[model samples]
Target: MIDLRSDTVTRPSAEMRRVMFEAPVGDDVWGDDPSVTHLEHYLAERTGKAAALFLPSGTQSNLVALLSHCQRGDEYLVDQQAHTYRLEGGGAAVLGGIQPQPLDGLNTGELPLAKLKAAIKPVDPHFARTRLLTLENTFHGQVLDADHVAQTTALAREQGLATHLDGARIGNAAAASGSSLEALCAPFDTVSICCSKGLGAPMGSVLVGPEAFIATATRWRKVVGGGLRQVGSMAAACEYALDHHLPQLIQDHEKAERLAAGLAAIDGITVTAQATNMVFVAFEDSAFAPEPLHAWLAEQGILVGALYAPRFVTHRDVSMADIDQVVAAFRDYFQRLTR
Candidate 1:
């Protein structure tokens, strides 16, 4: 099946697998794993953070950051639709006793600084203490404006609120924006970056922040079962992706543009948004039922979300030829529907 479901589904390349096979391993719980140590150091330096920790997944990475940043009853403000707040199974609330104040955000996933300022609870005992303001880059494949982020982080700092960034797709953001990785991560106090996403690693996420904060996150990681032994295999794959596949993300973004352009010409479909390896298409008419189109595409081995404005993701495994085939399948489906 042509899995446009998510970038997370991409398998590791042979070169990455070779590196994993030859990887040097050690006990990470004792802080001696060479591969994990190398990955953490590389991510920290690249993001300009004082330190970094390798976690099993993005969910754990974000959870550790949340646990480190906020205490029990302390609230972290986040976009209502962001992965950290809406997804991640409410780990912060359930496991850490940290509350998330989910707030309205723009389609680009930017929370208004004014709204954020207003949301910060006054020291009154009646409200949960607002401890952190979290933001997501490449929110639904839409990159947040750098100026907006700079201003928001500055405001948060002035208000004595710590800032965290859930940058599960920061490489995509960097690729699309022509910004350095460090430049993208410079504003926030903590960032959770996923290698398993568009980077094409089989699994791994690196959380970067201050040394003291990472120490705190390290403790949280252990409590949450992220302290794995001889995790070098996955760590090696992530490092391989960072070294080789990071630059190819532009091709993924370009293919998304191509897919969007092709889908826009279809009668019943509207390409609502396109950026950084993902396309969000909407049904032009409410009468245009999605089930038939989905079924037809599925028969052709083309996969997409089962919704009106379904999202299509492009990744390392999807080529230009695959993009054309997907477009053709979409065109054929619409053509048959019109018949």
Candidate 2:
């Protein structure tokens, strides 16, 4: 099936699998895995961070970063709709006792600087001390303005709070915004980038930050069962994705745009949003049941998520031909309504 559910459904290319098979292996928890070490160093240099840690997932990377930055009872400011806050299973609060101070972010995934100022709790025993300000680079496929990041982090510093970025789709943001990863990450104290998503790796995420902070996250990683033995295979796949598949995300974004345009022309379809490699769309027909579309699309060898506004994701596995097929399927579904 042509899966448009998420980029996370991506499989490593054959070339990536070859590298994974050939990668040198050692226990990562002991800091002896050469492949893992190489991957970490590569990402650190790319993002201009002093150190990096390879984790099993972006969720683990973000959680470890949170544990490293905030102590028990400390709060981190985040967007109400951000993955680090609303998603990721609340690992920060569950594992680190870190509280989240969620504020509504702008359409560009930026919190108003004034709202941030108002949200900061006065220094007192009664309030959860704000310790970090976390941001997502691509909030629901919309790239956050890089200028907004610099300004927000600068304000976060003035408030004596550290900053972290849940950059799970940072590569997508980089491609869409035409900004270097270093420029996007420069203002944040820590940043996590996932290779398992749009980058087409089997599984892995790299969390980059200062050496001291990474050291703290290291302990938390082990505590939370992220320390892996012989993890070079996964690390190698992620590294290969960085070298190969990262550039192709721009193509995925183009496909999403193509899909969006086609969906917009349909009489009963509402195109809510489109950015990077994701498209949000809804059926305008009052009698339109998403389940029927789901079943119909499945019959057409297409797969999508069951969201209120169905979200479509483009990835390496989806070709221009496949995108055309999806558009055709949707057109067929709607055209049947006329008859």
Candidate 3:
């Protein structure tokens, strides 16, 4: 089946598998895994950070970053819709005792500066001290403006708060916006880069920050049961993705644009948003049932997101030919409605 559910669904390519098989292995929990160390160093240099730590998932990476930046009872400012605050299972609050001060964000995924300034609690015993300000790039596939990111993060510094970026899809943001990874990351003190997403690695995320902060995160990672043994193969796969698949992100974004344009031309479908490698579409009429379309598309050897909101993600495994087929399938589904 042609899966458009998410980029995370991508399996390792034959080349990546070969690298994983040949990778030199050692116990990562002991900091002796050469492959894991290589991956960490590569990402650290690319993002211009002093050091990096490899974690099992983006969730853990973000959680560790939060734990390193904030102490118990301290809070962080984040957008209400940010993946770190809303989607990461609240690990910061549950595990680190860190509170989240969620503010509504603009369409570009930027926190309104006025509201952000007003939200920072003054020095008092009554409020949770704001310790960090977190931001996300490529929020719902829309790239956050670089200028806005600089401004918000600068404001964060002015208020004496540290900054972290849930850059799970930072590569996509860089590819789409024509910005360098280091340039995009310069505003924040720490960043979590997920290789499992558009990079097409089977699994792995690297958290990059200062050496001292990474040392702190390493301890939290161990405390949270993230200290894996012999993960060299996974690290090798992520390295392979960084070397081979990063350029393909631009092609994925192009395919998403193509798919969005095709669906928009259909009579009953509305293209609600398109950015990077993700496109969201919806039926023009709320009364329309999507169950039939889901079943029909499945019968045609196609798969999409199971959620009520229709989101299609283009990835390395999805080709231009496959994108055309998906567009035809959607068009055919709607054409049958009029008949």
* Model 2 lDDT tens row, 1-339: 999999999987888889999999999888999999999999999999999999999999999999999999999999998998888898998988989999987867899999998999998999999889999988999988777788899999998999999999999988887888888889899999999989998888999999999999999999999999999999999989988888778999999999999999998999999999999987887777788878899999999998566899999899999999999999999899788
Candidate 1 Cα errors over 4 Å, as ranges: none
- Give the per-residue lDDT digits (tens) of candidate 1, residues 150-260: 999999999999999999999999899999989999999999999988898888999999999999999999999999999988899998998888898999999899999
Clashing pairs in 1: none
Measured over all alpha carbons after superposition, the RMSD of each candidate to the real structure, in angstroms, is: 1.0, 0.9, 0.9
Best by lDDT: 3
For residues 1-339, what per-residue lDDT tens digits would candidate 3 score against the true structure? 999999999989999999999999999999999999999999899999999999999999999999999999999999998899888899999988999999988866889999999999999999999899999887999888888888998898999999999899998998888888899888899999999988988899999999999999999999999999999999999999988888779999999999999999999989999999999887888899988899999999999886488899999899999999998998898889999
Worst 10 residues of 2 by lDDT: 282-291
> What's the lDDT for all of these models?
0.91, 0.91, 0.92
TM-scores vs. true structure, each candidate: 0.98, 0.98, 0.98
Error of 2 at 303 (Å): 0.5
Error of 1 at 170 (Å): 0.2
lDDT of 3 at 235: 99
